[model samples]
Target chain A: MTGSILEIRDLRVAFTGAAKPVRAVDGVDLALVPGEVVALLGESGSGKSVTLRSILRLHPENKTRIEGSIVAAGIDVMALSGAALADFRGKTVSMIFQEPMLALDPVYTLGAQITEAIRKHESGVSADAARKRALGLFERVRIPSPERRLDSYPHELSGGMRQRAMIALALACNPKVLLADEPTTALDATVQVQILLLLRELQRELDLAMIFVTHDIGVGVEVADRIAVMYAGRIVEIGAVRDVIRAPRHPYTIGLLSTRAQGGRLSGKRLPTITGSPPDLASLPPGCAFAPRCSSATSACLEAAPAAVELGHGHAVRCIHTAAVA
Target chain B: MIFYASKRILFTLPIMLGVTIVCFALVHLAPGDPLVSVLPPDASQVIKEQMMALYGFDRPYHEQFLRWLWRALQGDIGTSIRTGRPVSTEISKAVGNTLMLAALATAIGFLLGTLFGFVAGYFRDTWVDKAASALSVFGVSVPHYWLGMVLVIIFAATLGWLPPTGAGPGGSEDWKWNWVHVQYLILPAVTMSVIPMGIIARTVRALVAEILSQEFVVGLRAKGLSELGVFGHVVKNAAPTALAVMGIQLGYLLGGSILIETVFAWPGTGLLLNDAIFQRDLPLLQGTILVLAMFFVVLNLVVDVMQTILDPRIQRA
Candidate 1:
C-alpha cells in the first residue's frame, strides 16, 4: 500500500437514520494502486456497494456516521468539508452507477450533464469548450452518431447506448480512479457484455484504477485483476482473480463458487446452495458471520471473529478453517 | 411543441361540447318556469305561450340546444334577470375582476408554497419541514370563507385600516390597480391564496422529496455539483408537476370563489353566480358556468403543454 493512489483504513459506515443504527460497512481496509482493477464480489447486503459508495463519501451527511480515515491522491478524504469535498469528487475520482436511466437526470440532455460536470471541475472552461470535450468522450466511448446522441435525453437512447452515454459522462473530467457499482446489472444480457468490454477498454486507455462491485463471477473474471469476496461487511477473501476463484481459501467463497453451474451446461441435478441465509448486518454475531451457513464450521469458529490471515503472493483469507476449505 | 399544444387544444373541444350540454340540461332539469320572473303574474296562459315561443323555449330540445349553443358561441348570452344588463357584459366585468384577483393570489401562493416546499424537502424531517407542513395543513384544513371573515374582522373591521367590501374606491364597478382599490383586494386575495398555497406546498413537497430520493441526485452530487446546483436540478424536475398543480388551482379559484366573494362582497363571478343562484337568473348562471368550465379546459391544456415542455419523459405522440 506504500505507493497506492487511494488508501482506506478501518472504514466503518453506519446509518444512524434507522431506529437501530445499521452498520452497513464495518472494519473495511482496502488500497488501490493506479491502473489496478479490483472487483468487490458479493450478493445483496454484503457491503460491496456500501464500501464503494463510502470511498466517495456518498452517504447522507446528517443521517450517516462514517468512522475511519480515507486518503486519495495525497488528500485526506474524510477531513474534506463543503467546498473541499466538492472539489475532491469528480476531479479526483468519479462513479458509474448500476442503472443508467435512473442515474442520469431525466430533464437534462446527456450533452448538458457531461458539459456541466466538465465546467464544474475546470473553472475556466466555457460551455462550448466543455461540450466539445463531451463530444470527444462520446466518440471515445464508441457511441454512434456521437454528435446527435449527445443532445438526446437518457430515455431516448437504447440500453447499451445509455450505458455508453453514462460511461462518457463518468470520464468527462478524467479522474484517476473510477468506481463502477454494478454498471451492467440493469442492462440486457447481450448489452451487458458490450458495456463491460467498453468499460474495460476505457479503464485501460485512460490508465484509471477502477473498483467494480458485482455479484457475477463471470464479470469479475472478464474485467477484474483482483477479486475481493465480501461476507456480511467484511472481505473474507482477497487475492489475484485467478488465485481466489481457482484456489478459494474461505468456506463462504467455496460455497458461492459451488452454487454456480460450472461450464454453462446444466447437470440436471440441483445446483448446490449454501444451507442458510446471510446474517443480518444490524445485529451480527461476535464470531464469523458465515459460520451459521458454513458446512465446515467448528465450535471454535463460534468463539470469535477470525482476522484476515495473509497467504503467499498477495492472497489472504479470514476463516478459522481455511485449511478445511482447501 | 406547437403540434402538441394544438393537439391538446383540439382535445378540449369534446370537453367544451360536454360543458355546453350540461349548461343546456340545467334549464330543463330545474323545476320552474323559464319566463316566470319576466312575465306578468296575472297574465293569461296565452301570454305564457307567447313568452315561451318568443324565447324559443317552445322549440324541440335539439332545436333549443342548437339555438342556445349558437348564441353562446356568438357571445350573445342573453339578459340577466337580476340586473337587466346583458349577461355577457356582467360576466365580462366580473371575469376581469376575478382574473385580476386570481392572478395576484396565485402568484403569492405559488411563490410562498415553492419556497416552503423546497426548504422542507431539502431539509426533510427537520423542524423547518415540520413548521412548513403544519402551516400548509392549517391552510388546507381551515375553511377559506371563515378565514376571509376573520381577516376582515382584524384588518378591516377592528383596525379600520382597509375596506371590508367592494371592488374599488368610490364603491364603483371599475377596478383600478391603485392602492385604494388594491387595499380592498388584500383580505380576499390572501383568503383565496391559502387554498392553493396549502395544496401546492404539499404537492411540491412530495415532488421534491421524490426527486431528491432518485439516484440522479446522488449522481449529481457525485459529479461535484454544489448543493445550489443540485437544488437547481430539483427545482427543474419538480417544476412541471408543481406548475400543473398551480394551474389547476387557479381554475378552481375561478368558480370556487363563491364563498370567499360572498364573505367579502367583491364583484367577481363568484358573487355573480351567488346572485344568479338566488334570483334564479338562468341566463347569468348558464353564462358564468360555461365561462368557468371553459377556463378549466383551457387551463388544463396550458398545463399539459407546460409539463411537456419541462419534462421530456412525457412526450406526446
Candidate 2:
C-alpha cells in the first residue's frame, strides 16, 4: 500500500495433468507503482498472459497449482476466498481481454451488464444510479449516441466500440490495478493505436497502475512506461521502455527488437526472426530456457540459467554474456 | 418483429396445404373401401353401391379431394363415415383432453429435465452428474409405451392405487380439472413424459456445458458476480437453445400423446385416430392428421418467435 499498488513475488503457476506439469509462469516477480503502465512483451507461449491472470487467481483451481504471493491494494489476493475474493476482483483489480466480442455477454444489453457489475460490488447503489453511472462511462469512452448505445447488445457495436465498452466495464468499479491482456491485439492497426492512446490517457488521468500485455514491441514502445520481455515463462529483460528498446541486452529481447518494422537495422531486409522455436515448458532444458534459441549461447549459458544482473538506470538483463553481447 | 411473425405465418400455409394433400392422398390410397368397412359383410352389392354414392366415394379422387378441401376451408371437415357425426365436433371433444395431458407432461418434463441438467452441467465429472446422466440415458432408451405399461402395472395393477385406463369414471365429464381427474392423468402423462424429459435433460446439459465454456462466461465471473449470479447469466444466455429444444419436444409430446392416450383408453385424439384407422374412416383420419400437422407448424412458429425474443442476436439475424 505504501510503495507499490500491486506487488507479485516469486509467483509460480504450474498446470498439473496426467502427463507432466507445465510451468506456465515460473517464479515471476513484478511490482507496479501508482500510475505506472508496464507492458509485458512476449510471444504466444511466453507466459505473459498467465502471469497477468495469476494476479486475479483466474486459472482453474483444481488443475493449477499456484505458489507465492499476490498483494494488490493492501489485500492478500492469493489468500482471499468467496465474498472476499469476489470483492478483490473488480474492486481491487479488473481485467480487460483481447477479444471484446467474446468478452461481452451476447444476450444482455451493454447497460444491463455494466450496471449489474456496479450493483454487485456496491450493494447500496440503486439500479437507476448504476445505470446513470453506466451512461457516464459510455460517454467517457466516447461511444456515439451513448444513451441509445446503452440499450444495444454487444453484437450491435463495432469492434472498436465493443473494446471501448469492455474497458468502460473494467473501469466501472474503479480498481487500482488494471490488467489488460493484449487488449488491442484484435483491433485494426488504426483502431489499435487509438485504443492504446485512449488507455494511456485514461491511465494517466485516473492514476491507475496497469499491466499491458502484448507481443508487439511497437505497442510496448507506444503505451508502456517500462517493458518486461518474457521468454519461455521467465522475464528475460526488464527496463524503462526507451532504455530496453534502445539497447536490448538479452538475446531474445534483441531478436524481438530486430523483427520490428520501424527503425531497426534489418528494416528493409528480410525480418530477423529468432533462429529457433521457443522451449516447451513441460520439458525445458536444465540451463536458461532460452539457451537453445539464443544465438549467443555458450557452454556456461548451457550449464546453468543466468541470474538477473542490474544495469544502470534500473535496467536488468538475465543472460551470462550480456556484456559480450552488448 | 411483426414482419417476421407474419412471414412465418405466411410460410406455414403452404406447408399446411401440402400436409393436407398428403394426408388426403394417403388415406385414399390405403387398401380398403370405406363402404365395405361401413356396411355389413353380408350386405348386397346394391347396398354397397348406394352407400358409396351417398358418401360421394364413387367420384374420381381429385373431385373428392377438391370437395373435401372446399368443405374444409368453410370450417367444416364433413361427417365421419363410420359415426355419421361431424368430424369437427368429434375432434373438438377429443382435443381438450389431449391438450391437458400434453401440457401437464411437458411442464413436468421441462422442469425436471432442466433441474437435473443444471445440476449435472454445473457439477460435471462428479457423482451427481453421473447419476443424472445415467437416468437420462435410461429414460432415452426406454420406449414410452412400454414405460407407460410398466407404470400402469406397478402403480395401478399391482398396487391398485388408481384407475388403469379410460381418462376417469365419467369420461369427458370426469376430466374437469379436478383432483379426481388428475389421478387418472398420472399414469399416461408420466408415460408420455419419459422420453421428452430425457431428451430435454441431455440437450440442456450439453448446451449448459457449452455455454459455461464460452469466453463471455469467464468475463462474467471476472465481473465479480457471485456463483449464483454467474449461473443466472448462463441460464439467460442458454435459454434460446433450451426453448428451441423444448419446442421440438413439445411437438414430439403432442404426437406421443396419441399413443399414450390410446394405451390408457383416455378418449383423446389418439384414441379417436386409432379407432378411425381400425374402422377405415377416411374423413376422420384425414381430419385428425391435418389438425396434428397444423399444430406442429404453429408450435414451431411460436418457438421461433420465443427464441427471437430471448436472443437479440437472433432478432437481428
Candidate 3:
C-alpha cells in the first residue's frame, strides 16, 4: 500500500438530475501499487468508467460533483487545481482513450503528436530530441516501418496501428500510472489480442502501474493481477484474478462468471445470458443495489445493504450471504 | 495539374464568351438607339447617314458584332462615339486610377479582416469576439454610399482633413507626382473596404472556430500546449479554407467597389462606364463591361489555383 502509485478512498460522484441525482460512482475505494495491473471490470453504466475518468478529473465540470480523496504520485487529486491538475495529468499519469481513432489528432502526423507529448512533460526538450524519442516509442510499440509511420497521419494507419501509436503517445511521458479505458474494445479480435499483448509487454518493460477498465472478464483475466467486479456503482467483489474467476463471492459476480463461462465453447446454439438488464443509476433499488436480481436475496438483504466482508488474502465481497453460499 | 487547369480554363472560356454575347445583344435591345441618343433631334439626313457609316452603325448587327470582335481581338476597342477617343486609351487611364485605389483597399481589408478574425477566434466567447461580430454585421448592413457620405461628413466636411469630391482637383493632369491626389484617394478606398473586411472577418471567425473544435486542437491542448501555441498551429492548418474564403471575398470586393468609385468620382471603371452611359458612348460602355467580366473570371481562376496550391488534398481531389 505504501508503494501504491494511486489510491482512491471513498470516491463518490453523482450527476445532477431534475428529480434526483444519479449516483455514478458510489463509495468506491481502490488503489494501484507501482508495477501492479488492476482491472476494473463491469458492464456498461457500472461506474467503472466513471471511476477511471474521475481519477483524472476528466468529467465535464458543472454536470457532476465528485467527492473523494484521489492520491496519485503523492499528489491529492481533489486538492490540485487547474494548472497543477493539468501538469499532473500530463506528467504523473497518462490515459489511452477507448476509441483510438478519436484518441489521436487526425491533422498532425503521429510523430508530431508524440513529440508534443514528450515536450509537454519535459521542459526545454528540443524538437529534434522529441522526434527521436517519438520514433523510438513507435518502434517500442512494435509499429513496423516506424519512421514512415511517424510521418503518417492517424487516418493513414489501420485501427491497430492507431491504437499502438496512442499507446506510444501515452507512454512517451513515462508516467508512473497508465489508465487505459477499454483500449482494445474497438479493435477486431486479432488486433485486440495484439494490443493486449503489446500492453502487457510494455507494462512489464516499463514496470507501469495500469488501471485497465473492461467489460470482458476474459480480457481482465488475461492481463489483470487482480480484478474488481463493479455492479450498480459499487465494487461487489475484489480479489486476485485467478481466485475471483475460479470462485466468485457476490451474486452479481457469479452472474457475470456464468454468463462469460457459457460463452467459452463455440456451439451452434446461442449462449445463456444474464436474465435482466443492469439497474438504472437514477432509481437504484433500496437497501441492496443488486437485491432485485439476486435469487438468494433474503428479507435482511432487502432491508439493509451489506458491508464489505474481508474474506482473507485480499479477497473482499459486499454480500451478506457469502459465508452461506460458500 | 497544368493539364487540369488548362481543361478548366478551356471549359470556362466558351461560357464566358456566351455571356459576353448575351450582354452585347441586351445593350442593343434596350429602347432608343445610341445614334438617336447621341445626335441632335434636327440633324440633316445626310449627316445622320454619314455619322452612322463613320461609326459603322449603318452595318447589320451581325456584321457590326464581327467587326467589333475582330477589332477587340486585335486589341483595338474602337473610338468612343461621344468623345471621339480610342476606347483602350480612355479605359487604360481610368484603369490605372482604379488599380491604385482597389489594390490599397483590398490590402487594407485583408489585413484588418484576417487580424481581427484570428483574434475573435482566439477569445471565442469573450466580449472582444462579440464586438468584432457586431462590427462585421454593421459593415455588412451599411450601404457603401452611406458609409462614403458618413466619412465625407466626418473627415472632409467637418474636419476639412480631405477634399469632399473627385479623386483630386488635380485629376489626370498632374497624377504623376500629386501627393494630394493620393491623400484624396484614401477615403474612397477605406469606404470601399468595409464590406469585404467585414465579410472576410466573419468567414475567418467561423472557420477558426470550427478548426479549434477539431480533435487535433484537443490533442494539442492535452499535450500541454499553451492557448497561443494551439491557436497558431490550428490557424496554420486551417489556412487553406480561410484563404479560399478571402479570395472569393476579394473578387466580390472588386465587383462591389463600383458604387464607391462613382460616389468619390475616383476615375475608375465605374466612373468611366457612368460617363459613357451619359454620353451615349456605345463602344466605351461595351468595352468596359467586357473588361469587368474578364477581371472577375481571371480572379476566380487565380483563387482556384491558390486553393489547390495551399492544400495538396484538394489538388489530389
Q: Which candidate is the best by DockQ?
A: 1
* TM-score for chain A in each prediction: 0.98, 0.97, 0.96
Estimate how well candidate 1 is docked, as a DockQ score: 0.87
The C-alpha stretches of model 2 lying farther than 4 A from their native spots are A263-268, B41-46
Q: Could you tell me the lDDT of residue B299 within candidate 3?
A: 74
Clashing pairs in 3: none
Model 1 vs. true fold: TM: 0.98
TM-score of chain B of 1: 0.96
- lDDT score at residue B236, model 3, on the 0-100 scale: 66
By lDDT, the best candidate is: 1
Per-residue lDDT, model 3, residue B106, is 77
TM match of model 3 to true structure: 0.81
Q: Tell me the spans in candidate 1 whose CA falls farther than 4 Å from its real position.
A: A264-266
- lDDT by residue (A1-326, candidate 3, tens digit) is 68789999999999984368899998999988999999999999999989988887766566788997999989998997666766777578888878877766655678988887787678899999999999889999989999999987777789999999999998888889998899999999999999999999999989999999999988999999999999989998999998898888898888888775455484675665677788888877777888888888888888776889998878999999999877
lDDT of each: 0.89, 0.87, 0.82
Across residues A1-326, which tens digit of lDDT does each residue of candidate 2 receive?
25998988888989996499998888788888999999999999899999998888888788899998988978998898888888788778999999989989999999999999999999899999999999999999899899999999999998999999999999999989899999999999999988999999999999999999998888888898999999888888999998898898998888887776666655568866778788889987878998887777888887877788899877999898989999
Q: On a 0 to 1 DockQ scale, where is model 3?
A: 0.30
- How far residue B202's Cα lies from its native spot in candidate 2, in Å, is 0.5
> Compared with the true structure, what per-residue lDDT tens digits does model 3 show for residues B1-317?
79767776887788677757865786788777778867889999998999889888889999988888888878898888777789998888877777777777877777888777887887788899999988888888999898999999999999999887786776654575467677888899899778778887888888888877665555555545655667667766667776776667666555436678777877788788788878778888888777677777877787777766655445545
